[model samples]
Target: MASKLAHPLLHALRAGGPAFGAWLTLPGALSARTAAAASPHLAWLVVDCEHGMTALHPGAGESIAAVAALGPRAPSTIVRIPATGACADGSAGWQIKYALDQGARGVLVPMVSTGAQAKSVVAAARFPPQGVRGFGSPFTQHAWGADVTPGEYLAHANDAVLVLVQIETRDGVANLDEILAVDGLDGVFIGPYDLSLALGLPPPSPDPHPEAETVIQTILAKAHAAGKKWSVPLRLSFRSLPRPNPVTNCRDLLHRGTQAAKRAKEGFDMVNVTSDSGAMSDGIAR
Candidate 1:
């Protein structure tokens, strides 16, 4: 039987190609549909609930449904949940449960600062025997975009779902080696803005301070050495491109295409192109 849980983004990462994607910050299915249909090349789409308008329950579910509606052609949907520290009474676990239940292909937890915290994120995302995720969501199959039985979904979810933790603080950088050592962690994502702040530099610098660059390089090298996938957000410029015009459309396409190529060349396993909010702002400005 065909593997019902196979994900294109997972395949891309395994094949060692950069999985390019866009961030969904808007809170609706229309926005998701538009973004997913914009490019067939997108390997995944991150439904940003942490900083975006997508709420945990209905909004996230709607967005996931919209994207997954594309079926095989849809970019894999991964949701970035709000911050959680360590185990913290399993609040993070509950969030993971809700996201997975709603049919997110993966979950990204932000602000993790230690190996213990990384382990907790993994436990919350995986099922028992490997971790502690419970399986009782009747609607999860819909989000998976496959016609698998519930038993099959449960059996394969542990390996199918991607579990990523953000390394964005001084403590997280200090414990990078230990965090990478945690089992069941699929990858680590760097929040360059917060990382800059943690490094005592200005937040959101176009050019990172030399010290912050060292930390970023260290995380990248260590993740590779541990055979784990690592990612960093790279926001591309949409300015100077007129919106709704063919000229602008060509420019946007070319710009994103170039950025995706550069990210692949840089050896990033996954890359988020830009956020929905950012796109909207850029359009309005244009």
Candidate 2:
């Protein structure tokens, strides 16, 4: 039997296929309309606090709250917390835990610079022996249901939680091997804009400088060797709207998929939707 796209992108990465996707911001407070917009494409949605989307409020970030609100609507939720003192203090990490407790499948730590940061992020995603995330559901994450069990949730989470570390700096690229060597990391998401800036190039440069690009490919190769996903974030933010194009959302992968298919005619796996945010209906942005 043909294997189904379980955990969609995760399954693709594990099967040595292209793992490409994009981001979505949890706008201020979430509404069902916002949830509906982001429920469509891509294997997962990265609820931004780090970059991509601008912050809508102060105190707690928008990503966590948005996930808490719309998680059930989306197939998989990945919250991106700021990589500042907030996350470094571990408070933001707990917010990530709370988002999971609310139903997020994973967390995306942005501007990840070292293996230590990766370790901390992984630790926060897990419960006890694996790490130290507290258990509290039966809330919106569990839909306030009586049927969800703590024990069951914990056990499943131990194996199912995915941690994606953002790689977007000169140092991050330089230490790519050691960072990928971190035991609990499930994957790395290349943050193209910051990476371009770090390499002393323009902010929106899609074609990475040869050496920098080589570093990125190396990370993907290493991640594949390590049995981990290499998630590339394809956000077409600067472009004007009418704002929904499948090609723009998964740019690099679209190109690679085309070339790969031409070279070998091998098939590729895909998630149910293309990109998970900005879905509109009745001639309005959702």
Candidate 3:
């Protein structure tokens, strides 16, 4: 097998330490650049095309470039494509290909409820004979942060790109074991809010409800047992708060940061600090 290219996010996960990241929801490079420069501790930046303003075509690619251009300190860019699964027509496969071709180091697929769905995600993100992804993007090398030729990129991309699936539904929770059993799936990201809704409970509480907490714990345990990285989105409230209150602003930032740290200490492999919209809104308000 050709040596897979180095990816900072994967390296951090393999290093046995928690990898922190930010979520990008706004559709521009400025927010991405600013958020990526906020803390060198960031290992990845998830461009949220699923629920955010970013689109797969040009928006995701632009934001990815902005984040990846931060040089060595740049966190690996992962595009969360706005699709649920690989439909019969193979729409998910094409979306995954576009995101990868645009230079995303990884792909975050949401609403994966079965092992079969995960298998499709993995296949879409990787190259053959391990997958069905077609190669031919001339600009892909730049997103990878390498200077290799197209052939070199293709030779190792199967292993180089990370494929993460979201476990956010009751069906997903029930099929957790099977999903984790899928080969080539690098990690699982838990969508707490969606998971809560899926469980027929009130939306995300200030703290997760007992039922949600139980589900979260189960997912974390199973992921660790399977030797796969698990991540959670930790939304910060600073953006939602009324600004002009320096003390309150500081307190909120500190509180959110602490919560993220606590999650990491509790064994989450990755934690999202904040999103582009959150940071930008907070910055503008300040």
lDDT accuracy of residue 190 in candidate 2: 75
Q: What lDDT tens digits, residue by residue, belong to model 3 across residues 200-248?
A: 9865534567889889988999999998999999865554444446666
| Candidate scoring better on lDDT of 1 and 3 | 3
List runs of model 2 lying over 4 Å from the truth.
1-20, 26-41, 52-74, 85-92, 140-147, 237-286
Choose the strongest candidate by lDDT: 3
lDDT of 2 by residue, 4-86 (tens): 21244455445665533445543544532354354344445555656545342331234434433443333344666665422
Q: In candidate 2, how many Å is residue 268 off?
A: 11
Candidate 3: lDDT over CA atoms? 0.83
User: Count of backbone clashes for each model?
Assistant: 0, 7, 0
- What is the Cα-based TM-score of model 2? 0.69
Scored against the true structure, residue 233 in model 1 reaches a CA lDDT of 81
* Predicted structure 1, TM vs. truth: 0.89
List of clashing residue pairs for candidate 2: 38-276, 41-273, 41-274, 41-275, 42-274, 42-275, 102-141
lDDT of 1 by residue, 1-286 (tens): 2356647788788777788888887889999988988887888889988988889888888998888887766888899997656653566888888888888889999999988888888988989999888888788886675687788888788888999999998899889899999999999998877789878886432345688778877888899999899897865444333345645645665676676577578788898877677676656645
* By lDDT: ranked, best first: 3, 1, 2
What TM-score fits each model?
A: 0.89, 0.69, 0.91
